[model samples]
Target: MKIIFNRLYADYLMPSRLGEYEAILRQARDLGYAQLAVRDFYRSRDRSPPGRVLVHRHDIDSDLRTARKLFALESRHGVRATYYFRLCTLDIGFMREIEAAGSEASYHYEEVATFAKQWRIRTPDTLRARFPEIRQQFARNFDSIAERLGCPLATVASHGDFANRKLNVINHELLNDTALRQQCGIECEAYDDALLRHIDIYISDRKHPVYYRPASPFDALGRDRAILFLTHPVQWETNWIDNTRCNARRIIEELAWRTSASC
Candidate 1:
């Protein structure tokens, strides 16, 4: 007996697989995009090269194995990317390996949301009341991750949690206070106005193509400008068949988590 995949499902599966991702990268390269890691983008402010540039960024939500595979592929193509990792998904070995492979590493933070939820903060006023605790927790987590990596983490990206509506706090808000930036010794948050000024477009593949709709500005890369491409490892697979299965499992798992959290 033979099993057939629906055309719509097959189309949805293309973007998240390894082959499609590689094709995208090759297209960008052919279009004269000089890929830069996040840290490099930060460094090249006034002296940015006169051409199109792609800032490749990866938020490693989970699944270290896939992340490593992506890293290897990028390495082979002579490309470097910045990877932001969550504290909950810390993998020192993989982190070191990726860093060794010429990728930059930074923390993917959601401390504000996590703190607000844990303390049952329901209003912005209440969130402000617990700012001290939140700041301290952020410092501790950052320090611990930095220490483990044996490197000074100069940048961070907020792990946006759209479901938590009560607190109205975002991780990037913690960097609003100059004192917080000084205290944590962090130079830049990925979403900061200063940093965003350099980026002409931002695209992300948070969920697979079918679920998460992204404004794919990269499709029209005719202008000589900076583009930030954010990707997650779990979304990409070796093939569409595997990608479809992975996306299905991820959707179910996310739904279950959200349902339990709501309860």
Candidate 2:
């Protein structure tokens, strides 16, 4: 019953979210908020002038086409945002286009958590036992992706893989070790402590009706606030039919996760 309701909500109620996404971006621009990507915001967190700032980030979990559209829209509105791509969405051409738009393209990492799921490291002690191997893969993949992008990624956002819930581990947990961060050339994680400390408000479009759960971005405009926004391109739809298909896929994936995790 809940699954059916969720599918209806995603496929029907949220089809106009893409427009809402643009509306907020445009509103911020008009209100004199300086929009910056994740990398730039983090690098200059201390020296930011006293004003309204919006730090926008997009995680491309699926639907590269939608992500590209979102990128172009942001570029049109003179908004710079960081785009984090999973392994499937990392296209050199699109990433270069994003760079051309003056936005940051980085990695959305899930390798370590996947390793845990594959090895069935269901407990903290077992996960720690295989930490070496898992960490090695994380670094290797990060390096490999950086080499492919032809530049160092300033921040990597950990992916919340369904496998993570079954394994009792988070992908970014490995970033706790400062040494690992240095070895991988990661300047910061998406949820860095410093970022959380500095930002006055954090908003994410990962959930339903994101603009209003706590409050709307419009309400925060004109105030001196540091706002961090995380959006998944797949969640907002340009086509109703396509969005229905996407929602169906997610529903299937959710059911599969629930079933597999139970075993």
Q: What TM-scores do the predictions have?
A: 0.80, 0.86
RMSD of each: 5.2, 3.0
Q: Candidate 1's C-alpha lDDT?
A: 0.74
lDDT per residue as tens, model 2, 1-263: 87667656765675656777888888888888889998888888888544888999899877787887888789888889999998867897888778777889998988766665565444666776777787888888889888887878889899887667756677888788888888877887988887778888887764453434355667766664788877887667644665666567667766654555421
lDDT of candidate 1 over 39-85, digit per residue (tens): 87877866846488888899986666678778878887888899999
The C-alpha lDDT values of all candidates are: 0.74, 0.77
Extract clashing residue pairs from model 2.
none
lDDT of 2: 0.77
- Candidate number of the best TM-score: 2
Specify the poorest-scoring 10-residue window by lDDT in model 1. Answer: 1-10
Candidate 1 RMSD to the real structure: 5.2
